[model samples]
Target: MLDPDRIRVVAPHFKRRLSGVTSTVVQLIPAQRRRGLGIATLGPGLPETMPALSFAQLPALWKKPKGAAHRVWHARRNVEMLAGIVLRDLLRMPLKLLFTSAAQRHHSRYTRWLISKMDAVVATSARSGSFLKVPHTVILHGIDTDLFHPPEGVDDTIAGTSLPGEHLIGCFGRVRHQKGTDLFVKAMIELLPRYPSWTAIVSGRVTAEHKGFADGLKADIARAGLSERIVFLGEVDDIKPWYRRLTLYVAPSRNEGFGLTPLEAMASETAVVASDAGAYREQIAEGMTGAVVAAGEYEPLRDAIEAYLADPGRAHLHAKAAVAHVRADFALAGEAAALEGVYSRLLGVPATSPQS
Candidate 1:
């Protein structure tokens, strides 16, 4: 049984499938809890540790918490936005509506309409704000530095898998055409033969629709007789060790909302070579932490990888800088505190004390 009366903030996630938005909610709620915020989720596909409010608990919003004004309903999806509107307007629930936008492209008319109903909006990055019809506060995404930190000492083997390589260049995320997985593969094919010391790894899930695309890349790797040099480890439960084991991490997505892989790699003290998609350019300090290349271009990515492989000393230095950069600038607690401010303002409550 949930004590809905204690809920001060409601983060609704109506979508059943796990996606980037879902991942953010999972990572965020725990951090928000650490700040002593009375927030909870209301949806499927979320971890059990996070507090959740049921449909029966919906009526509890009408009974405001002692001394507080109104509860807040934060939505991340169009459907979730609609639900918030219905509860506040149609059902006459006493709740303030909030929405966070992360799409980098123009939204559909329905989406725009849903956003128009929001009391306030949050954009994941400044680039994403350009596509928003309404003004939004830009709150960049952050990774869990504690979970994805540098290894005690560098290791050759990836902990979860048997994939062995002297140096691993990783391309992580969904394995699909849009993600520029092919570009990463092409770059690897052209350069791996020359740099016999380094191997490339693609670690991600290939959805049913993109299984053929993933298979095609494997075929190309085989045709080049470099199949052994390029490995596809599918999806793993633990990704920290993979990032920790990598000499360099590549994010070749053609487009992104606010790519977090580079930050994850940086947090793990690994040098990165990422396509200028989403917030990659802003996240990376060129020549200091990592290098950002033109999206969808294979030559630039190839050259970046080659340069890193040739002079690994430079890569090691950048990796150290990346770890420092992430710890200082991209802490998850910072994002959670920023969000808490937004929620507190909407509820007419004092801002929570900033977390470290």
Candidate 2:
């Protein structure tokens, strides 16, 4: 239970499943609160770590804070946007509606119509901004550098697992076709045989619908006689440390809404080889931080991984540069500060002591 009077921002998430949007809310709200912003999430599926409001507590929005202008309701989904419009426009609540757009392609007519009614809009990336029909601010997502960083020693193992390998390469996300899991597996099967020192890992959930797809990959690994070297670690409880254990990280997705795995990898001091899917191209710097291959093309992906395996010294240099790149540009606090400015402007008050 939270004091309705103290709340200045309400962020709503409708989906129960863990997704890119859900990940953003889970990571951002805590950072926002740490910066002294009075914000709370209003929805299901969020972890206990996030500050949240109950449906019963929402009536507090009917009455604005004593001196504050109005409460800002930030929505990330079309359904949530419509809910905000109905609450503020139709129900006469003193709420300002702001929607954050993450879709990279054209929006549906219905989604565009809903966006048109927002008081303000935020795009997750410049590419996503191009698809938005409304005037918006571009705010890229940031990772918690503290939570995901390089390990202290050289022999780092993925905690809570018996998996062992000298060098671990990984592809993490949903185990489905759209994520290009098949492509990653194909590349690993071809490369792992020659490089006995390195192994590959695929970590993510396989929905009941995608069970066949997951099973096929496992069968392929067995047929290639590299089943022991190529492991499938289902969804992990703590993924940050897993990144620290990796020598090379791969993001071979066919589509994404500004994927964060590459950023997470770079922050962990692991070099990456990602496809030109989602915001991955924006995250990596060719030979500096990591390499990028064309989306859906496994041949180039294979070549990139092979190059990294052949030259571990060069890859280590890139990994060190990656750590510096992420620290300089993508801190979670920076994202929280930028968002505070948005809320401050909407409410006509100081969000915080001006960020540096």
Candidate 3:
């Protein structure tokens, strides 16, 4: 538990279900704490190990923390933004509200009204920022290179599953149409027979609403006699190691909110073939690190993946370059430092030097 008096910033995760916002909060809080920022999480769903302020501590926000005029309330979701508004406006708390937007589409009028109340705004990417009607700063998300690095030895098999094939290709995330899982499956069906050495892995949850869609994909795989070659891991707890097992990682999402899979795969020393969705094009260096084709285009996606599958040496070269690119531009530490700057400005305090 964090002392309410010591907390200079509060990150609230209201949603009980695990999501991208929740994941971001879980990864970022520790990095910010390492920089000596007096930040803590509020609400449920977050790991108990995280520095957190209880609901009982909500009253403490009425008073300012030591050496700061006001506490920064950083909200990533709309409900969290509403909570900040209630506390700062209706209840009269000493808080400066901040909201980070990741949505790439036009906002609803209600959402825009809520955003207008924020003291500061952050967009996860330039495209995300363009959708905002208010002033905002763009801060791209980064990955933890130490956690997602290349494997030490030549171990191809995944720990628990006896999945075959020397070269593994992966597409991870929700098994829904929006994620373009079908495109990956269709492409695999066409290419897997030609390249006997390669296998495809699809890992992610299939919700009740999308169970039929998932079943349909499986049936198609069965019909093609490629069920064994195309495997669905179905949402593993630890995905970092899975990234390390792949020769190629594909993010074929038809739409996204600043996707991070490409960076995760690249950080794990695996080359990527991604659709031009989210911030993938910004992250991947076309021919050097990975290839980015038009989103939702089947033929182009198939051809791009074939290029990497056809030439192993080129893929290996790109994988090597990817590690360097992510470390130089998208390390988690850099994001922590950048966000600390945002918090500092909102709190009207000088940004503290990151603790060594």
TM-score list, all predictions = 0.95, 0.96, 0.97
Model 2: residues >4 Å from true position, as ranges? 154-164, 354-356
Candidate 3 local lDDT, 313-355, one digit each (tens):
7888999999999999999999998998999898888998888
Candidate 1, 1-356: lDDT as tens digits: 66777778999988887678887888888888778788899988887877898877777888986557888899988888999999999988888899988788989999999999999999988888899989789888887888888977535345434554567789999999889999999989998878877888989988999999999999999999988889998988877788988889999999987878899999998999999899898899999999999989888988998899888788889999999999888889889988888888888888666345
Question: Model 3, which residues run further than 4 Å from truth?
Answer: 156-161
The candidate with the higher lDDT, 2 or 3, is 3
List, residue by residue over 38-91, the lDDT tens digit for candidate 2: 889999999986789999887778999756979999999988999999999989
Local error of candidate 2 at residue 212 (angstroms): 0.7
Cα error, residue 223 of model 1, in Å, equals: 0.9
Poorest lDDT segment (10 consecutive residues) of candidate 3? 152-161
Top-down TM-score ranking: 3, 2, 1
lDDT score at residue 200, model 3, on the 0-100 scale = 93
